[model samples]
Target: MSRLTELLSRIKAKDPKIGNELAKEIKVLSARRQFGLNFERHKPENVELANREVRRGDKIRVLPQRGSTKNSDKRLWQVKDTFKKKNDHLATIELLGHDVAETQVVKVEDLIVVAEFQDSIYPGLISTGKVEKGKDKPYNTVINGENYHALKALTFTHKGKIDAIYIDPPYNTGAKDWKYNNDYVESDDHYRHSKWLAFMERRLVFAKKLLNPSCSVLIVTIDEKEINRLGLLLEQSFPEAQIQMISSVINPKGTGRALFSRTDEYIYYVFIGSAKVPDKVGKGEEKEVRWRYLRRTDDESARGTKKGGPAQFYPIYVNKNTHKIEVIGEPLKPEDDISKIKNINGCVAVFPIREKDEHHMNWGLTKPSLEKALSKGFVRVSRKEDSQIQPYVFSYLTAPNIKKIDNGILYKKGQREDGSWIVVDPSGKSSRPTTNWNEKSHEAGAYGTSLLKALIGKRKFPFPKSLYAVEDALRIVVGENKEAKVLDFFSGSGTTAHAVMRLNRQDNGERQCISITNNEVSADEQKALIKKGFRAGDPEWEKWGICDYITKPRIEAAITGVTPQGKPIEGEYKFNDEFPISDGFNENAEFFTLSYHTPLAVNHNLAFKQIAPLLWMKAGSRGKRIQELPERGWEVADSYALLVDLDKSSEFIKPVKASKSITMVFIVTNDDRRFQAIVRQLPESVEPVRLYESYLKNFQFTIE
Candidate 1:
C-alpha cells in the first residue's frame, strides 16, 4: 500500500528474481531521467608536458617498455626528487594510488610528465622557425602543441576577433583515430562516443570565445561516423548561433560495410551574430553573361539629337578581321559630317544610329566613358545583317550588369584575345549554398590525398580534406571580408592554412590563418620507436610527430614552391583558380611551439619575451613582433603599440597618434583608473588594453 511496496509490486511482475533470496535484500530507489547526452563530465583529461623539464612534486608516468605485458604500470606518480646519477638523469617518484607509499627511481628520459585539465598552467609560445616571402605580409602561424592548451591561450590573444574558424577534427571512427585520457578510443571502447563529445565540447567552448562576436563563422567537417551526434553537440554548444549542415561528397566511391555505400560527409557552418553567406557563386553554378547594345533603343526620344547629349554621339571602332572593339573615338558634333571622320587602319567605325530611320542614336556612355569600358572588355562588336550605313553594331554591358560585376555577383572567367573581359553570371552563386554538394574537385582521393602527395611528395597523413572543399567553405563565409582572420585548432596536415593561402591568391586578400596541432607520432611509428629504446619526448621519437613530419613540412612546401627535399613541386593546382605549384604563393608564415611557464615567472613580468607573439596576434598579426622590452617602457610596431611603463604614457600617446596604422595599445599596469585615464588621451581609433591583469585573468583555467 506504500510507495516502496507499489514500486516492488511493479518489479515483481517483470523479474523472476523478485521473490528470490537475492531480491529479498533489494531496496527500491528513485530513478532520474537523462533526457539528452550524458557523459562522464568529471573524467580528467591528461596533457603530456613533453616540453617541460622534470621537477620535484611533478606528476609523472613511465613510458611503456617494449617487452612489457598488458599489466604495465598505468598508475600516476609524483616526483619526490630529481638528480644526476652516473651520467644519466634520474627521478625518485612515489605512487599516487590508494595512499600507497611505494617509491621507485627511474631515468628522467624514460618518463613523461602529464598535466590534468584542472591544473593551472601559464602557457606561452616559443618561435621555432619562420618562412617569409615578403616583409609586408602578416605571417600565417602554425603552433605545434596540444590544441586544448593552444585554444586556451588563444582566448587571451584572439578572443572575439577571429572572422572564421575552420576545423576538421577527428571523426572518432573508432579505429584508433583519436585519443581520450592518453589512450586511443578504439572501436571496442564502450564510452568512445561520450568521450569524443566531452572532448569536443570543451574545445568548442573555447572556440566560441575566440570567434568574432559581431560577425564570424565556425565550420566543422564530419562523416557518418558521428554526424548526427556531432550535429546535436554543435547545437547544444552553439545555442545562440545559426547552424546549418551541408552534405558534401568527399568520396564518390563509397567505403562502408553497410547496404548503402557511404559517399558523403557533412559540414556544419555556425554563423554567429551578423555573419551571412557572401553574394558570390559557388562551384558549378555559373551562367553565360548576356550583353545588351549600348544604344538607347527602348525610347525614340533617347535616340534623337534633341534629347541625346553631344558627348554621347561617339563612334566605336572594330577591327575588320578580328571583330574586336579596338578603339573608341571622340564624339562628333550634331551638325558635323560622319563621312569626314577618318577611318583608323582599316578598322570599321560604328555609331549609335537607328537602323530603321537613319536617326543618330546616342551611346549609353559618353566617349571617355566608352573608352574606359573598352579597356575593361565591357564593349563588344556584333555583325549587323540588315543595316546599310554600318555593317557592324556596338554592344556593351548595361548599368545593372556592370553593377553585378562590381558587387561580385558576376565572376570574371578571364579575358578574351581582344582585351575584352569575359564575365559569367554565377546562377545562385550569391545565394545561400544548398544542403547537398557533389563536385569532382571535392573528391578526397583525387584532390585531397593526391594533391597533398603532389605537394609534399608522399602520403604522410591519413586523410586530408580536399583543398577546394575548405576553400569553398571559407570563401562562402569570409569572401566579402578580404582581411579575415581564420583559426583552425585541429589543423592536421595544415590544410586550413593552405586553403587560406589559396583564397588569398584568388582575390589578392590578406586573410591570415592560425593552425594548431600537436606533434603526436603515429601508432606504427610509436611501436618502432619503443622497440628502439626511444621514448616519446626524445628527439628521435618526437621528430616523427604529425606536426614535424607532415604539417610543418607540407606548409613550408606549399609556401616555398619546393618539397621538403628541395625538389620543385611536381603538379599544378586546379579548381576555382589554376596555377603551377612551383610558382608558390607570395605569402609569409611563422611556426611556433606552445611552451609552458611557471605562474611565478609570468606574474613577475619575466615572460615578456615569450608572450610577445600573443600581443602581435591580438593586434591582428600585422607586422613583425616586438620580441623584447624597450628601455623607454614603450614601443610601437606596424600595427600595435606596447606601453610597459605607466609613467611613459605622455610620450607613448604622441607617437601612437602620429602612427595612424597602430590600432591597439597594451598598457601594462594593474590600475584601472590610470589605464582609463591614459586611454582617454589616445585617439578614438586606437583601442587601449590593460596588460598583466588582462593577460593573467585569461589563464586562470576558467573554461575547463
Candidate 2:
C-alpha cells in the first residue's frame, strides 16, 4: 500500500471522522511545506527527547524567541541537508525555512527538530562568582538564568540527584511583582493566574526530573493569593507523593492596618519515596528564655497605667550623673498625702507614660518591686533627646525582654516575676511548632528585616525570608541527610543559601544548596533605563535585577563571612535563649550564568573545550581535576572522564575499569556504529554517555 493509504488506514482504525479531517489538514500543509517523515520517529507527548537524527525535510523550532525582537522572530525552519563531513560528533544542516543554506552556523544545543529525540543540554556553565585561583570547587552552585531553560539543563546534569526543592514563587497577585516572557503579568490582565500556572507547570515538569524519585521533597510557598491553585497544581504534578501544607505566621499584627490581615503564608510540601519530615526538636526555642514584658499594665483596664491601680504605681529614682537607678520610692497609695512623704533624696524620679496620658501617668512599680528589679539589673531606661532628657521604659527593646502580654496570648511559662516578665517554667524543653506561630523569632520586623539590615547595612530587597525560618524548614524536612542537595530556584535575597551555610555550621553537615534566579531588572528600573536609551540585556538593566544586585552579593557575603558592605562579621549572633548562631559559616560556592555557545564547526561538531565544563558539572561538579594535566592523553578525574581523542580510548578504559572509581565515561565520536561497538567492549561498571549526539542532532533544519 502507498504511504498515504497506510497512514489513513491506521488513522481510520482509531477514528474515522478525525482521520478524514486530519487527511485534509495534511494535504493542505503538504502543499505549503515539506516535512521529512523518514527521519522522524513516533514519540509520545510525554517523551522529552526527540528522534536521534535530523533529516532533509524535518521541521525545526527556534527557542527563546522574544516576540518583539528582530532576531528569533523567524521560526519554523526546515532542514535542506543532513550529512557528516569532518566528523560524526556534529552534523551539518541547511535551512529551507529561512533564506540560508548553512550560513548561520548553529549550535546543536540551540534548535529542536520536530519529531526527534527531545533531549537538549545547555553549553558550559560560565563562572560568575569569584573563585580562588587553583581551588577545586566541589560545593554548591548558583545559576543566573531563565528558570525554565535552567531547569531543562539541570535535567541533563542533575537528573535523579536532588534531595530537596524549595521554591517561593511569585504569588501572582497581579502586583507586577513578576514578569512572564518579556511582559509584566499584572492583575488587570485576564488569565494572569492561568499564565502563572502554565509557566509553573513547564518548569515543574523538569524540576521533577532533577529530583531523586526514591527520596526527595518538593516544597512550594505561597500566600492566600495562589495557595488554592498551587495546591491543586502540586496534587496534579505529584499524584503519588504525600502532600501536606503548613500555615506559618509571617505578619501576625495586620490587626488594625487591614481587614482579615494576611498574617500567615502556606508551605506546601510533597514528600516522595522514603523522604521523611522530622520535627525540629533541638532548636534554641527549647532552651529556656526569660520572656519579659517591658511595660506594666493595670489589671482592671488591661492597659499600662490606664486607670485606677494605685499601690503598684510609683516612681523609681535614677541618678542623673550615672543614668542608673539609685533609689526605689514608695507609692502614693490613694491615701498617701504626697506632701508628707519625701521623694527619694539625691535622685530624679521617672514615671511610666500611659498611652492615653503618657506624659502624666505614674510609674508602674512598688518600692520593693523596684528595688528588686534594680538589684537584678532588669530596670532599663532610655532617653531619646540630647539636651533635656525624658526617660521611657525600655522593656522588650532587647532579646532579654518580651512583648507585654496584657492584650495578647501569654505563651507557655509566660508570667510576671518580682518586677520583670519571666517564663514560669525556667527549664527549657524542645516544643513542636504549632499552627499559630507568634514567637519573637518568627516576627519578620525584628528577625528578618532588622537582622538583615544590620548584617547588610541596607535593605535593598523587600520582604526577605527570615534566615531562621528557612533554616528551620530545612532542618525539619532534610532530617539527617548530611550532604543533601538542596535546590531553591526562587532564591530571593539568598536566604536559603544563608540558611544552608548556617545549618551546615550547626551540624557540621556538608549540605550543598543550589540557588537559581533570573537576573531580570525591575519593571520601573527597566523603564527608566529605556528612557535613557537603554534596553534589556544592557549593563544598567542587569544591575537592577534581583539576582545580581541582591541575591548574589548577599550569598557571597553570607558564605565569605562578610557583611554586604564587605566588612568582616564580628561578634556572636545569639538567640534569646542563648543559642549562639555562627556569625560566619565560611564556605565556598561556585556561581554560574546559563549561557549558549554557537557551533564553531559542524557535522555535530561540538568544541570539546567549550563543552568540558558542562560535562564536569553533570558529574556533580565533584571532579578533583579542574583542568587537563599537561602531556596527559585523556581528560579525567575520579568520578568522570571526557575522551576527546578516540586513539586514547584503550588506555583510558584500562585505568577506569581497574580503579572502579570512574563511573561515567564520555567518548567524543560521531560514529554511532563505532560508539556502540566500543560500548559493548566497555566494562559493565561504568556507564557510557555520548558526548555530542543530542547536541549535534538538535541544531539541524536542512531541506532536500
Candidate 3:
C-alpha cells in the first residue's frame, strides 16, 4: 500500500468522521499518484466565455491592459452595476466568492466573462452561415467554440451515435500553440505536461460518451511530444477499448533538430466494441479477393426519372436455377413501369429495389458497365433463404478490384468453372492493419498544406492535417457504412470535414460530418490586435480569429469548389478517389457559433429557434431542419415528426403513423405519464423522445 492508504487506515481508527472526509481526498490523490501514467488530474480548465453583455451577478475577468505583455490580475470578479461614464462604458465589480466590501470601476471592454469547470452553462447554437450545394443530403455542421463545452452540448444530440471521431488536438509543443485556463502554456511552465493531460483527459472523457458503444472508433493524431502520454491517457480513459498506435511519415524531409530529425507523427486508433480495421489492397500490403454488394445505399441511390435519372437504374435477368446473370436490360425510362418488366426465358428480372424498402435504390454499375464487368468474370449472384422484396443479392468487383488485377497488385489464384476468377491479396494476409503506415498521400506538406493553399489560396492556419491521411483513417473504420456519422471536435482548418466530403463524392455516400473549433487568433495577431484598441471579445478582434478567417472560409470554399475570391479551385484531388477540385461536391454545410443562454429563457421555451437545429441533428440530420416553431400543433418533415403542442396529440398521431420514413418523434410535454402514453400510441419504428426531459434534464445533470 502507498503512504496515503496507510495514513488513511491510521486516521480512520482515531476519528471516523474526520477520516471519512480525508479518505475522499486521499482517494483522489491516490488515483493520480498510483497510476503508471499520472498527472494533475483534477486541475480545472477555465474557458473565457465570449459574446455576452456584462450583467449584474455575472462573473468576469479583467483583460490584460493594452501594451502590457502579461495578465497581472487573475482574480475572478462579479458584476455589481454598469453605467456609461462620459464616452466610456464602465462596470462596478467585486471579487467573486469572497465577502469583500471593496468595489472597483473598470472599462467594460477591458473585462471578459469567464466560466470555470463545473459551472452550469446553458449552451445553444446560432447559425452564422450556410453553404448548400445539394438537397437530400445531411448538413455538415461546423461549431465555433471551446471544444469542451461544445462536446457537452453534443451529448444531448449525439451521445452514443457517433460512428467515428477524428481529432488532431494541439501537440503541446510549447510554442504557444495552445492555451489552458486563458493562459498560454509555454515551454517554461512547470506544469505544462500536467496541464495538457488535464485538458485532453476532460475532452476524451466526453468523447467516450459520444461514441457508439456497439461499434465505433476514436482516432487521435499527435507528434512525438505527447504521443506516449496520449496513449496512456487513452488506455486509462477507455480501458475496455482496443488501442493501437501507428507511426506515419508525414514529412519526408525531417524537421531539423539537435539530434535526430523528426520525420513522422503517431496516430492512435481506439476501437470500441465490435469496431475493426478495414481490409484494403495497397502497394507493399497484402491483397485479397474482394466482392462488395452491387446495390447502392447512399442518398444518390434513389431512383430517378428518365429525364434526370441514374443510368445504373436498369434491370438484370438472373436465371433462378443456375443463379447466373444472363442478360442486362436497357435503362428504364420515366414512363416504364417496373411492375410491367417481366422475366426473360426462365430468368428473373431484378431491379435495384432495396430491402426493408428504404428506397428504390439504383445499382452500383450501369447496364453496359455491368455487362462489361460480367463478361470479365467479376460478377456473382445469390439469394437468402427467405428474402422477399429483394429476392436476389448481387455482388461485383469494384474499381479497386479491377485496378489491382490490371496493375498486377493481386496474384490470380485460379479460375472457377463458371468463368469467374479467384484472386488472393498478398498484403498482410490478415484483416488487421500494420502498425507502420507510410504513404506518399499522407505527406502533410504536399497534400495538406499545398492542397489547402490551392483551394483557399493561402496558408491561413498552421499544421493542418493531410486531407488523404484523415480520409484513409476514417475509411478504415466507417468506410463501408456509407452513411456514417463522423465527428471531429478538434477540427483545425476544417480538414476532417473536407476529407469526409471527398469520401462521399468517391462512392456517392451520404456520410455526414460535424466539426468543432475555436476562433482563436495567433499570438502575433493577438499582439497586433492589442496594439490597436480592441479587447478579447471585441467584434473587430474576433473577426481575425482562426474560425472566422480560416476554418469557416476554408470549409465554404471546399464545399462550393471556389476560393474566397469566388474563383474556381484549380487543382485535382489525388489518390484512391481522384477528382478535379473544380468539380466541387454535392453537399451542404452550416456554420454555427456556440451561444450561451440564461436558464430562465430556455426553461420558458423562449429558445426554440436555437434548439430546433439540435433537434434536427438528433433525428439523424436528414431532410431540411425546421428553424421555427410550427403554428400548428404538429409538423412533419421528411425524416422526423415534431409535436409542439401536447393538446394536439390526437391530430398528430394519424399523420405520424401514416408516414413510413419518419424515424424520430419529439413530443413537447412535461407530464411523464402523458408522454409515455403518447409514445405507446406511436409506431414501434419511431423513436419517441420527450422534448423537455431529453433537453433540459440532460443539461441539469451536466457532467463537469
Pairs that collide, model 1: 280-429, 281-429, 377-420, 377-421
Q: Measured by C-alpha RMSD in angstroms, how accurate is candidate 1?
A: 15.0
Q: What lDDT would each prediction earn against the true structure? A: 0.80, 0.60, 0.82
lDDT of 3 by residue, 539-579 (tens): 89898888888889888888877788877666557776544
Best-to-worst order by TM-score is: 3, 1, 2
Cα shift from native, residue 388, model 2 (Å):
48
| Worst window of 10 by summed lDDT in candidate 2 | 37-46
Candidate 1, residues 269-347, lDDT tens digits: the string is 9999999866555556886576665665434434435667678877778888887877778888877888888789978
Candidate 2, backbone clash total:
28
Q: Which stretches of candidate 3 lie over 4 Å from their true place?
A: 1-25, 32-35, 64-72, 83-90, 97-99, 282-432, 702-704
Candidate 1: worst-modelled 10 consecutive residues by lDDT: 24-33
